[model samples]
Target chain A: MTRQELFEQIKIKQSFLCVGLDTDLNKIPSHLQKVADPIFEFNKQIIDQTADFAVAYKPNIAFYEALGPKGWESLQKTLDYIPKNIFSIADAKRGDIGNTSGLYAKAFFETMDFDSITVAPYMGIDSVSPFLSYENKWVILLALTSNEGSLDFQFSELKNGKPVYQEVLEKSSKWGNPDNMMYVVGATRGEKIGEVRKIVPEHFFLVPGVGAQGGSLEEVAKYGMNSRCGLLVNSSRGIIYAGKGTDFGTEARKEAKKLQGEMEVLLNQYCY
Target chain B: MTRQELFEQIKIKQSFLCVGLDTDLNKIPSHLQKVADPIFEFNKQIIDQTADFAVAYKPNIAFYEALGPKGWESLQKTLDYIPKNIFSIADAKRGDIGNTSGLYAKAFFETMDFDSITVAPYMGIDSVSPFLSYENKWVILLALTSNEGSLDFQFSELKNGKPVYQEVLEKSSKWGNPDNMMYVVGATRGEKIGEVRKIVPEHFFLVPGVGAQGGSLEEVAKYGMNSRCGLLVNSSRGIIYAGKGTDFGTEARKEAKKLQGEMEVLLNQYCY
Candidate 1:
């Protein structure tokens, strides 16, 4: 999806929350196990309940991959279940050799029907450029992550003096315009969001690590938000797995609504 | 698998080639189209034909993901098709929020049964750390890429005066020891291989962009090889899709044998 379309969705929905479908078989309510595909069953319910509250649904590819063939079937079914208006992301951080990368582009953008897919830019331009070739498709590159280990390399001072993450943000910006390229900047690093914004101020960011990871939505909006409400704040475990019982879907909707309500306020304050 | 196990495989085969299963449904021969899952059929044939010539089989995740439900099924079948003696990799470059990333770890290492996965470390420690938590599973972080666009950010001079890719290598070294972590250093960036080695000499490198991208195998081995044969040179289109006819598998085997033969000589020259 183009940046403008995403912005429009955010404006229309009065929300910028992107619900993450990190579905786990074991964690899903046992009552749904009898269904043909428990993972898809869980996702369908969550999407049904939270569709009104979220502007996007980001499915981490790993979760679907774990269930083997059955898990994958559920993931496809879940994608089919999502409302068309909401942006869909295959959160698969993929990058590789050029020909190989081209095939990957065909997979995520042409075949899977996702609006966007998370990408790792470490392989440089070729690895990411293939994804950008598709019109209206987005490539969410990894920038500054939100984990404690982020200190291990992201913040490390390079010989040129800038942190490694800053270098990625600056150089990778040239590959595609803000319309086709977004970034994965963790909400946990709220203090550094301002710095990230300066690097690619126009691009959207898939911000994870909120809710259960302890990152504050207020901080992310204050520092990272753009005029377009260019932030898809994701909350996985705290939402979908909010309850272990039969009301898991309802509980997930409550969690999503709470975040969406806050996001609406944030949008009003910053999305001018 | 640990670095020791990977090295042993390389030694036993007398080669360090990692056959890239960047399988595309459209590219498979007409004979294979009759199968329920053509991508898997092609991968199985390639694996069976070339297993003796390769130490590892790296399946780029994009190919499988593009097909949606069917693509994922093929990926699983392909993974299972590979012999246990050969290292298997879900070339899914994944890195995300911590809790979600932990689930991704379970998907690739625990569920799908891959020995390692390609990761984009742009998210910092939290995104990568979860993948590293798996015992004997390796995280191949993006380091220096080989595409023309790589010059945009990967080579950009950081504020600290070093290039961003160099800093990524130096900082991410601490996340996992050489045993658990590897780096993706493109073969196209031949000149910089020596510089990368200076930063993380012990870690194995998953090098792509060799055959089709015009990267020289001799140059990569000369500058990048360490005492442990620290490289898993990959070739995708130039090998697997060498021909588009019924002899595709035969052609793929021939291409793999050529690369493996070169790799065997390199291993001997480097005395690994």
Candidate 2:
């Protein structure tokens, strides 16, 4: 999807919420395991319930890959089930050489048909450029991640006082504009969100680490928001696994609705 | 496979050669496409031919993943076919949060039964720790990549004058001991291999860009080699697609044998 289209969706829904389908068979309700493909079934219900509130759905590829061929089948099913109007992201942190990355671009963009795929920037331009080849498709590069490991190298000060991620932001911005590129800035680094905004004010930021990871949504909106509401705050476990019982779908909707309601206010205050 | 076992395999084979199974449908011979599963069939033939000369088989995961479900099935078959003595690497540069990285660890190590999976170090400790959780399995973190993009952020000088890749080597060494951890130092960065050796001398280095990518095996062996012949120099397109005609297998084996012959000399000169 185009940046304008994505921004439009955020405006129309009044929520830049992206529900992460980190669907694990063991975590889903045990009753659903009786089905041939429980992960898909669980995701279908979760997507169905949360679709209205979420402007996007990101299927964490690791969850699907763990199950092998069956997992991939479930992933394809989940991708197909997501509403076309809503943006879909293959949260597959994939990057390789130019040729190999092109194949990945094809896997997520052409074959699987995700609007975006998360890419790691460690390999640099060639590894990421292939994903940017597609029109309207997005490459959500890992800028400042939420994990504890983020401190090990991400925050390393370069020779010019630029943090490694800032260097990543600066170098990568030349490869693609805000239209086709987004950065994954962890909401756990809430205070630093402003730092990221200062670098790429126009580009969208896919902010993970909200409820379960202890990132405050209000802080993210306050610091990260732009004129186009340039933020996609993702809540995976917090929303999908809101309840383990049969009413899990309803419970998930409740959580998503709660976030959406807050996002609606933020959208009105910032973008709208 | 255990570190000792890997060393033993290298000694027995007289080569630390790793054949990269970057199988693509478009790249393989047309005659093979007539088969039910050309990618697997191609891999099976390559493995059968080069199994004696090579100590490891590294399947570049993106190639298979691009084909969707059928590609995954082909990958499973290929994995099952590889001899137990030969180390298997899923070149799936994957990394995420702790939980998600755990799932990825399961995907490559448990479900797929790969001995190692290439990991991107942008996320830090939690993203890498899960891969280290498995006994005997390896996490070959991206240290200094072979591609031109490696110059982008990997070579950034930190506050202490340590290059970014050096920092990656220093910090990640704590996550996994030499037994379970490895670093991918691209063959293209042949001169820098000695610098990497100084940092983590005992750990194995999965060196790519050897043949097709213009990396000198002699330079890699000279600088990167350790007491255990700690290098799995990979040659993908050069060996696998050596011949597109009917004699593809024979040509591939010829290339493998040639590399193996050179590796044998290096082993004798260095370790023995």
Q: Write the per-residue lDDT of candidate 2 for residues B169-235, one digit (tens) a residue.
A: 9989998899999999988866799999999989999999998999999999999999988899999
List each model's interface RMSD: 2.9, 0.7
lDDT of each: 0.83, 0.93
In candidate 2, stretches whose alpha carbon ends up further than 4 angstroms from where it belongs are none
Off by over 4 Å in 1: A1-9, A157-162, A189-191, A198-201, A224-227, A269-272, B1-9, B159-161, B189-191
What candidate 1 keeps of the native contacts, as a fraction, is 0.74
Candidate 1 per-residue lDDT over residues B1-272, each given as its tens digit: 66777778888888888898878777789988997778888888888789988999998886777676677678878888889878887777777657667877887887778989888766677778888888888898888777776776677676667777777787789878998888989888677998999899898888888988789999999999999899989888898998889888899899998888888899889854
